[model samples]
Target: MAETSPIAIICGGGPFPFSVADAALRTGRKVHLMPIEGWADRDRVAAYPHDWVPVGQYGRMVRVARNAGARDIVFIGTLVRPSLKDIRLDWKTIKILPRIYRAFRGGDDHLLRNIGKIFEDDGFRMLGAHEVAPEILAPAGDAGRVRPSAQDIVDAKLGLAVLDAMGPFDVGQAVVVTDNVVLAVEAAEGTDRMLQRIAALRRDGRIKVSAGRGVLVKAAKPTQDRRFDLPSIGPTTIANVKEAGLAGIAVRAGEVIVAEFTAVTEAADTANLFVTGLAPSSPP
Candidate 1:
C-alpha cells in the first residue's frame, strides 16, 4: 500500500534528503519533498516535486503533503534546533503553541519525538529514512580500502561505550577517542564543528597525540526514536575526521545512515582513513 502511495519527505540540510528520495523512487514510490527553507539545498530540491516550507508552518506542510496524496513522512538531513521566538508560527502551529513550548523544554530527541507525535495525531505515519531506503544504512566491516588497526578498534569500542553511557542524558551522538582517552564529545555544536574543535586543539599543541591516532565513533542514542535523527555519516564526515587527525571512523552497522556510500568510500580511501561499520555487539 505504501509503495503505491506517495511519501512526504521533510528535507533538511545536506545530501541525505535527496538520497532518500532517489532510493524511494527506485523502489517505485512517488515522493513529494517539503524542503525546510534556510536549511535544505534549494538547487537540489528543484530536481524533484517539492514545496518550500518555513520552519513553523506545520499547517502548510500538512496541506501540501495531503494535496500530493502522501500519507507517509520521512524527516532527513541536518537541522540545528531553532529558538521558539525565531519561528514564524502559522495558525496551526500557534494553536498548538502550548505543546510546542513544552517540546522545546527538552533535548533534541525529546523535541523531535514530540513534534512527530503532533503530526501522527493529525493523521500521518512517520518513517525513518532507513525504512524508505535500507541501502543507505551502514554495512558491517570495512567500508573502504584502509582498515582500522587493533588500537583504533579498541578506541572505537571505548567511544561507543561513552555514547551508550551518555544516551540517557540526550547528549550528542559522536565522540573522539585516542588510547582509551576521550578527546572530545559532540554537543550542541554538532559533529563537524566538534571535529574542527579537535583540529584546532591539535594545531595549538594541546593534543600531543600524533596525527592519525584517534577514531571518530558515532551511533544513535540507545532509546532514540529511529523514525527521526538516526546518526549519519557522509563524505564530508570523512573529510572532517581527516582534518581532526583521526585515523578512521566507526559507526554501528545497520543503525547509522551512510549518505552517498560510493563517495564516502572513495573519500575514505583517498584520505587513507579507515571507514568501518562496527557490529552492534562489537567493534569491526
Candidate 2:
C-alpha cells in the first residue's frame, strides 16, 4: 500500500539524507536517491536505491529523477559550496552557465532558488523533508528532559527576533545569546563555527561571559526556502552546545529538523543540556 508512493531525494551530505531515507522507508515509501558524489555518505546511501552524480551535473539529476517516476522531489542536508575551479560542467550544464553564474554570485539562496526553478520547470514538485519524514520535525516544546530557564527563554525570544531581522539579508538561521546580549549570529561560517567563536570568547575572557551562561537558538530565516535550508540539529550539535556552555538550545516548532531526535535528546539528558522547540516567528 505505502509502496505506491514514490519520491525522489536529492541529497548533499551528512546524516540527514540517511535519516530521511530511513523514515520514508518505514512508512513504505519508495525512495530514489540522487546523491552528490564525495559529499554524500556512500555506504549509507547505497542501502537505498541511489544514483551518484556530481554536484554540478544538473542535467543528470533531472534525468535520474525523471527515470524514477518522481512527481515530487525533496532536497536535504548540507552542500558545501565548491570552489569554481573544482566544478566539472557538462555540456547541458554549460549551456545554462549564464543563469548558473548569476546564481553563484548571488549567494546560496539565489543558487538554490534557481535550481528549484529548474526542477519546477522540469515538472517535479519540490517537497520539504518534513513532508516525507514528519518524525524528523521538532515538536512543540520541551524537546528534551531539561527545560529552558526563564532567562534562557528570554534569550531564545530575543535570538529569534534578531534572527528574523537578519533573514532578509539572507544572514543566517541561528543566533547565540547571553543574558539578553547577542553573542554570535551564524553566517557563512555555519552553526558549528559560530558556536566555536562563542566558545573561544569564553576562553578569551575578553567578553567576560562565562560558559553555560547563554542560549543557542536556531530557526529558519524569515525568507528561507523551506524545501532546503531547514535548520537541523543533531548529536554533534548537542555536543557543541554542551561544550559551548550554553544553557540550552531552542528551535522553531514544526520547522526544524531534529535529526536523530532520540539520540540527541538522550545525549542532551546526559550533558544536562536543555532542548526546546519554540513557536516559529514571522518576518519583521
- Predicted model with the maximum lDDT: 1
Model 2 scores a TM of 0.94
Tens digit per residue, CA lDDT, model 2, 229-261:
788899999888887888889888887898888
Task: List, in order, the clash count of every candidate structure.
Answer: 0, 1
Question: What is the TM-score of each predicted model, taking all chains together?
Answer: 0.98, 0.94
Off by over 4 Å in 2: 1-5, 281-284
Q: Which residue runs does candidate 1 get wrong by more than 4 Å?
A: none
Candidate with top TM-score is 1
Candidate lDDT (C-alpha), each: 0.94, 0.84
> Candidate 2, clashing residue pairs?
212-245
lDDT of 1 by residue, 60-134 (tens): 999999999999999998999999999989999999999999999989999999999999999999999999999
Overall local distance difference test of candidate 1 = 0.94
Error of 1 at 49 (Å): 0.5
